[model samples]
Target: ARPRVGYFYTGKTGSEIITEKLMKYKVETFQSMPIVVKEDDSAYDAISAMFLSDVGTLFAVDQDNNLVGVVSRKDLLRASIGNQGLQDIPVHIIMTRMPNVAVCYPDELLVEAANRLIDKQIDSLPVIERSNETGAKVVGRITKTTITKAFVELARNELM
Candidate 1:
């Protein structure tokens, strides 16, 4: 017995193209209600509060609402284990700062950008763009789950 590879005249599955084509499917931050916090806020309180609000991650923004950093559950857990007083510590002290953060544009093909997740071994990518006449800022986040679900849908559509 041997294996078979399904082949069609269409190229590259265009998962990238298909993903990009589905840009209309992109959901806005206001629609999803992203978790955001000021850098000066208490890391523990903000994280705990957002968690209670059903948010899995939090974005740290500056007074300009520019994305300055990000904090994940693991980061918060590590900080908490290291210092109980982190509850009062500012989020800036615990957040993953810029130059170290991972980001993706909302228009970027979900399939192409999904590779960054495995390559960087991260759970999500902050969706951002240059603020009008200013620095970059996070507008939202795209999680692994988002891309995975999108791909599954694409696959299903092909079958149909």
Candidate 2:
């Protein structure tokens, strides 16, 4: 028997509602333009590129413009403090090489990308397209900030 004395029915729990909304988002809708550097570029150059772009993560690409590795501000910082000059150390030396790097696609669910970021303990994921025969071409990036923006926007929409 249904309780009708004082209870009112709600369609879904708050968490359930949020999850359903979040699940509907795809990475393409929230991704930001990728910041990339050549694999052979110096660590110093990578740092400069990151600083100039105001991005913490930089995708390292080969001559073919295929994503070869991923580097972070921390990696550049570590290399900068080493005995060797930052200018002398190639980005490939300090980057997390491909296959070892976590990546997502534009069509991937935003929730899955968020989970990937959490599970990998990474700051961002390079959005890649595998249709190319050369290799995976980095298309965009999904960062914690991007995910936060998505959540905030969703909340704002709900409030309105």
Candidate 3:
């Protein structure tokens, strides 16, 4: 706001404003529908699903829709090129299983999720709802591309 003949200070720098907005972002705000494959599905099937859905990662799920593992494009490429048949090898065999997979929740801060993605050196993370008895349910996915888009949007926003 402007005064009759002077300007006022909000006490926040442009970088601070960007940080404030970025920190307020939640996983649910930018997460997209997740692509998934059954734990029993073959590596061949996973490759097909990944290509068909245009996703870099695929969540591995059980019959109850509980997250069992995560599969990356690199995992498939490495497993698929082996002499052994991909169709005969289950995705679970090539996936990063529970206790090793990185995940986020709908209410989690987007920055936290992005940090996990970078720290874990992964392209994507499953957004899940956890239940001690039922296991984590894969509800969405957050990718590096999505985080970059969010930052780009913030930079383009009217902040001055």
Alpha-carbon TM-score of each model against the true structure: 0.74, 0.89, 0.89
Q: Model 2 — TM-score against the truth? A: 0.89
Rate residue 23 of model 1 by lDDT. 55
Candidate 3 lDDT (Cα, 0 to 1): 0.90
Candidate 1 lDDT over residue span 39-154, tens digit each: 89886687776768676678888999888888888878788787458767788888899979888775665554677878988877778864465766676777777766776766
Give the whole-model CA lDDT for all candidates, comma-separated. Answer: 0.72, 0.90, 0.90
Q: Cα RMSD to native, each candidate?
A: 6.2, 2.9, 3.4
Tens-place lDDT digits, model 2, residues 1-160: 6567788777588999877877788888889999999999999898889889999999999999999999998898888788999989999999999899999999999989999999999999999985848699999999999888877887689421
Candidate 1 weakest ten by summed lDDT: 24-33
Clashing pairs in 3: none
lDDT of 3 by residue, 70-127 (tens): 9999999999789999999999999999989999999999999999999999999999
Off by over 4 Å in 2: 2-11, 158-160
